[model samples]
Target: MTLYLHLGAHKTATTLLQNVLKHNEAALEERGLARIKIQPRHLFWHLYRDGDRDAFKKRRRTLARKLQQYYKSWPNAVLSSETMFGTSDLHRVNCLYPRADTALRVLAQLTSGMNRKVIFYVRRQDNFIESSFINRLQTLATSLHLDHAQLLSDTTWCSFEHYLSSFTPSQLSWLHLIKRMEAHFGAENLIIRPFESIHRGNAAYAESFLAPMCATHDLELAPQVYENRSFSAKALEEFIRLAPKQGFANLRSLRLHLQDKYPNTSYPRPMLLSPEQRQEILQTLATENSILFEQYFSDVDRTDISYQPVGS
Candidate 1:
């Protein structure tokens, strides 16, 4: 059996894609694909964070055997997780995917001696950082309450301005991340796409992601399912203003309350970056993006890789 893993870069409609894939599980099964919905936290999370080589090796072998069983039953076994490359917290180190190499190496070891492929979608740097920062705040608010001191000291509570300034343009390069993935998985085994391809329309975006599952040209998929909608700009503004004053549960409730009151259909997404900032980011990454196109996505539209604003 061939293993298909979706290694998310985050803020790239990963949830939506997962939902769509799940919705069409029966169809995929008929087409020789099975969605393997294992909780990554139990396997990949421990492997990525733990330094004990003996324990890591033990878990890797256990997981590999589990995969082997799935392969015996199905021709295609699939796993999808956004955290496979590490969390947005890695940005605290002032780099996009600082631990990605280590994560990829772990993955390479796990799927060793098997036919494995990885799907990764990458957004433009400025949009990715801004959306990732907002998503990180939402994620953290649901987990732990921060006192005034923790709020001040915690990287998660920092303003978008500080977060954006934390990394140099080179540090956020998708090219650098892709090279690491290619090093581990081989360029031929990776399926890479621009996150902005959703701009072609949702149906097109769904098709691009589902392409790897196609055993033939006529594989059918469910209509696109939208998931994990972003909080409105007003909702996020209120969240940041009141998060420290509230408990974690209260913060989550307040966020949901605010989201209901000021949905994205009425309010815009958080436009933290100005037009100038966006252009600067696009210009800075132009060379690397060009090389990315030439090397991996020569058939994709160059215009699709251009700067698309966060909520646009």
Candidate 2:
């Protein structure tokens, strides 16, 4: 069977895609696209890296059997998780484990004999950094005693800088993850696209994501789909502000309050890098992005990467 792994670099529409596939799982399976099931924190060794060393390996045997079952009956079997790309840990400064060696080794073991395809979505760095910060801040606002005022002081540039520093720009780029996966799956099996392009034509990202893979295999995806986009910044800010004033017990009530207030308007986005800063960063990335485009999208005249495709 062909194995399709939809990895997320966080802040992408990974959850929405999962929710849609979940909605149409049975029909898609009948059409030869069975999504491999994964436990929330287990598949990618998230809990294992968090110190519960016992959580990941045990599940691999069952997953391997599922992979075999797909090999026997299905034309195309799929797996998807944002955590697989070391994304869920973005909120924390220095996580227990930033590397994904254990997860990768386990995956390599489980999908041993299958033709593996890796698909990932890319978002612009500035927007990605902002979205990631807001999501993390919201998670903290609802759960922990965080310094929301200080975080809100001026802009989130410093916070974003701190996060980018942890991984460094080179590591933050998907080219890094793509190279790592290519080591295991090879460049021919990799399919990378921009998060924005996937959502083009007024289609939901989830709706557009699976259809193409099906077409490549001469199969079709289920027509029906679902979407669960992330929350807006206004709602997040309200959550932080009201969580303390109304107490954590009343956090839900406060959330309803903000949802009613803004309806659809997102809060103002954080300070993006200035033109000079952006130009400098792009200069640094020029060669690397060229190499990435050369390796992955050589035939296409353009690439999803922001640092202009080679020979713009």
Clashing pairs in 1: none
Which of the numbered candidates is closest to the native, going by highest TM-score? 1
Clashing pairs in 2: none
| Cα lDDT tens digits for candidate 2, 191-282 | 87666655353244554577655642332232344333344556655555555554445544555566566433454434545566555555
**lDDT of the candidates, in the order given:** 0.73, 0.59
Model 1 Cα lDDT, one tens digit per residue, 1-312: 788889897888888788777777877888888887676564556755556678767777777777778777888888888886667653446466777887788779878888999998888777787787777776665422224446645655657777776667656778888888889989999888888888777667777787767653454433535545567888888877777777655766777787788777678888888888887777777778778777776366564465433343
Off by over 4 Å in 1: 47-58, 142-149, 152-158, 215-225, 307-312
Model 1 / residue 187 / CA error / Å: 0.9
